[model samples]
Target: MDVALVTSLKDGMNLVRYELVACQDSKRGVLILREFAGAAQSLGAGAILVNPWNITEVSNAIGQALDMEPEKREKRHNHNFLHVTTHTAQEWAETFVRYETILSMKLLLLFLGLLSLINQFCGTSLPLLVASSDIILVY
Candidate 1:
C-alpha cells in the first residue's frame, strides 16, 4: 500500500525507512518506528518512537504524525534525509576496511618485532618487510 506514514514493529536494518525518507524529499512524511528496531537508534531523533504492542499509543502516534505541522514535518524529514544521504553503504564499508586495515597492520608489526629478534639471534634475514605506502585503499 502507498502511504505517507511508515511504521515498523521490529526490524534489522530497516531499509524501508530510508527508502521512505529518501522519497519524501519533496513531500515531508512521518515515520513511527519501534524503539527495538535497528534503524531506531539512527533515525529515532526524526521518527516517532512507540511500542507496537500498545495499540492506543500506536493509534495516537498515527494521529500525531498525520496532524503534525508542515514545519515540524520538514524538520524531522531533513534530519533523516541528511543521515540517509551522508551515511551510505559504500561509505560504511570503506570506513570498516580502513579501520580493520589499520588494526591488522598494528598486529602484523607486533609479530614482525618478534621475528626481528629471532633473525638477529640466528643470523638470518626476513623478507617480511611491509611499507605503509604499499597498501593503498582506493575506495
Candidate 2:
C-alpha cells in the first residue's frame, strides 16, 4: 500500500515524493505493490517502506522512516517526485467499465444532450430511435 507515500512531507512517512504518481498498470495489484516497494527502497531510502504482510515489520519501517534525517528524506522525496514527473504521464488514471453499462449510459447521455441542444435551437421535431429499431418523432 502507498499509505506512507500519501503522507505530507514532515509527516515522517514519505512513501513517495508526493508531487506525482503514475500508477497506470494498477492502483491495487501485487506487481504494483512490488514496484512501489522497489521504488521506495531506492528512492525513499526505505523510509516509506512496508511489508504489508508482517505487522511488526510495517511498524518498524514506519519508525525507521520517521527517524530519518530531514535533509536525507527531502533528497529522497525529490528523486521520487522527479521520476514520477519525468518518466510517467501526468494523468493516466485507468478505470474499468462494463461494456453494456458504458454503451447504454453513453447513448443515453448523447441522446439527452442532443435533445437539449435541439430544444435550445430551431423549433422543429426530431426523430428518436427506440429499442425496437423504429424511428419515432415528437411534434
Candidate 3:
C-alpha cells in the first residue's frame, strides 16, 4: 500500500490532492487498486492535503471496500460453518463405529473363555463344543 500527497500545477495555481493506493498479489497478476476518480472516491475536505499521515485509516478504508465487494462476499458464504460442521460430524461418526466393532470382538473372546472353563469343570468332552470351538478358531 502506498499513500502520497500529490500537487498538480495548472495555470500557475497549486492543486493539492491526497491519493491512496492498495494492491495485493493474485493468481492472474498483481491486483492494482481501483482509481479513486470512479464510483468509489475519498470524501476528504481540504484546501490542501494537511492531515497527519495515518496507516490505520488507509488500511481500514481498503478493508471495508474489499469486504463490500460482491465476489468476496460470495466466497465467504461458500465456506460457512454449516458445511464445515457436517463434514466434521461424518468423520467423527466413522471413528466411533470402528471403535465399537473392536469392543464387540473383545467381548466375544471373553464369553468364549467362560464357556471353556465350564466345560473343564463338568469333565465332559462335548462333541458340539469341540466342533464349534474349531469353527471359532478358524474365524
Candidate 4:
C-alpha cells in the first residue's frame, strides 16, 4: 500500500484489484503457494485467500475482495502496511545471503531442488530462472 495504490486511496478511489500484484499473490508462508515463492502469510487477514489452480475459487475471491466492508478494508490495509514497513522479501533475501554457509555451491543445488516445488506453485506459468543475485523477485 505504497506509491500509486495508497495515492489512489488518498484521492478517494477504492481499490478493486491490483493488476501487477493481485490479491491472490498477496499471501506468504501460505503453504499453498510456498512451493512457488517459499513465502509465508505476510499479508493481513483482510485478503481474500484462494487457490489459483481453482478457477471457481479465484472468481469467488475476486467477488469477496470487491465486496469487502470499508471497516475491514481499513484494518487490512493497516496490517499490510505495518508488515511491509518491518519485514520484506528483500530483507529475507538479505538475511539468507548473510548466512555464510548459504552462499556456498550448495545454494545452487538448493535452488534447483526448489524448482519442482516452484513448478507446482506455478501451474501454467513458465519456470522462473533465478540467475541474478541482485534481483529480488517479489509476489
Candidate 5:
C-alpha cells in the first residue's frame, strides 16, 4: 500500500484516508480524495479534493500531490493526524450525549420529521435509529 499517495475515486465513508493519516510515520504523504466522499467533509481542509468525473482535474491533483513540498505535506498531515487522534469514539459519544441533552424540542421535532420522511421513503424501521454526529445511515 503506497500511503505516499492514496486516491479514492468515490466512496461513501472511506476509512482509507484515516488509515493513511494514522499510518504515516513521517507525516509526509499526500491524500487525494474524491470531493463527493463522506470523508471529504472532514479531510478536505488537509487533503487534496478532486472530482472523480473530471479526468483533467484528477490528473492535475495527482501532479500537485506529487510535487507538494515536504513542509506542506507534513503540515497537512499534522492537521489530519490531530483530528484523528482527538475525535475518538469516546469523544464522539460524549458529544452526542451533550448534543442530544441540549437539543431543543423544536430541533428534535425537525429531526424526527426528517427521520420520518426518510423512513417512509427508504422503508426503514423506526423502532431503533442510530446516528453519528455527521451522518445518519438507516438500515
Candidate 6:
C-alpha cells in the first residue's frame, strides 16, 4: 500500500499560513483530502476535513471558503505582451510556414558548421604526436 502526501501553503494576512494536505494513492487512482488547517492557533484560520469519496462536496466547501466578495478586494487582471491573438486560416498558415522555414534553416546551418569543424580537426596532429612519430620511425 504505497501512499504519497502533498502539502501546499498559502500565506494570508497577519503572518498566518493556511495549509492544504492531500494524500494520493498512485496505483489505485485515489485522491484523499486529508487536512486543510491553519499553521498557527491564534489566527482566524479554519479547517474543512473531508472524505475522499465526497469529491464534489469537498470541492464546493473549499471554494466557498476561499471565495471573496468583489467589493471587498481590488480586482486585478494580468496581461502578457507575448500572448498570441486569434488568426484567420491564411494568417495561421503563413505563421506556421515562417516558423518552420526559420527553424529548419538554423538547424541546417548548425549541423554544417559542426561538420566543417570536425573535418578540420580530424587529421591535425599536435607536437606530442609528431615527437612520437619521429621516435617510431627511428626505431
Model 4 CA lDDT for position 68: 60
Q: Scored by CA lDDT, what does every candidate get?
A: 0.77, 0.46, 0.37, 0.45, 0.77, 0.36
Cα lDDT tens digits, model 1, 1-139, are 1224445644655588889888875778788887677888888999998887888998898889888888998889899999999899899999999999999999899779866755665654534433455552221
Error in Å for residue 94 of model 3: 0.9
| lDDT minimum window of 10 residues, candidate 4 | 29-38
Better of 2 and 4 by lDDT: 2
What TM-score against the true fold does each predicted structure earn? 0.74, 0.36, 0.28, 0.38, 0.64, 0.29
**Candidate 5 structure quality by residue, lDDT tens digits, 1-139:** 2234445654555577888888888546888887877877887898998887788998998889888888888888898888888887899999998888778766889789877867676764455455769876655
How many clashing pairs in candidate 3?
0
Better of 3 and 5 by TM-score: 5
Select the stronger candidate by TM-score from 1 and 3. 1
Sorting all predicted structures by TM-score, with the top scorer first, yields 1, 5, 4, 2, 6, 3
Candidate that would win on TM-score: 1
- 26: Cα error in model 4, Å: 18
- Please give the distance, in angstroms, between residue 133's alpha carbon in candidate 1 and its true position after superposition: 30
Q: Any residue pairs clashing in model 1, and if so which?
A: none
Those runs of model 6 whose alpha carbons end farther than 4 Å from true positions after fitting are: 1-86, 125-139
TM-score-wise, the better of 1 and 5 is 1
Residues 1-139, model 3: lDDT tens digits: 2223332222122122211211111211111122332211231221112212445554554455444555553343233322333445578799899999999998799778867766665665553333354454311
User: Stretches of candidate 2 above 4 Å error?
Assistant: 1-47, 90-139
Model 5 alpha-carbon drift over 4 Å, by segment: 1-10, 101-139
Per residue, candidate 6 scores C-alpha lDDT tens digits across 47-133 of 333443466776764564345333221111001001112233588899999999999999799669766766666676632221243
Error of 1 at 112 (Å): 1.8
Candidate 3, residue 31: the lDDT equals 17
Q: For candidate 2, lDDT tens digit of each residue in 75-130?
A: 54555555566554333322233566788899899789777866765565555433
- lDDT per residue (tens digit) for residues 1-139 in model 4: 2211111212122223322134333332111111112122444243445545566765655566566665665566555555555665688888887785667767788778767657676875564555456764432
Total backbone collisions, model 1: 0
Worst 10 residues of 2 by lDDT: 24-33
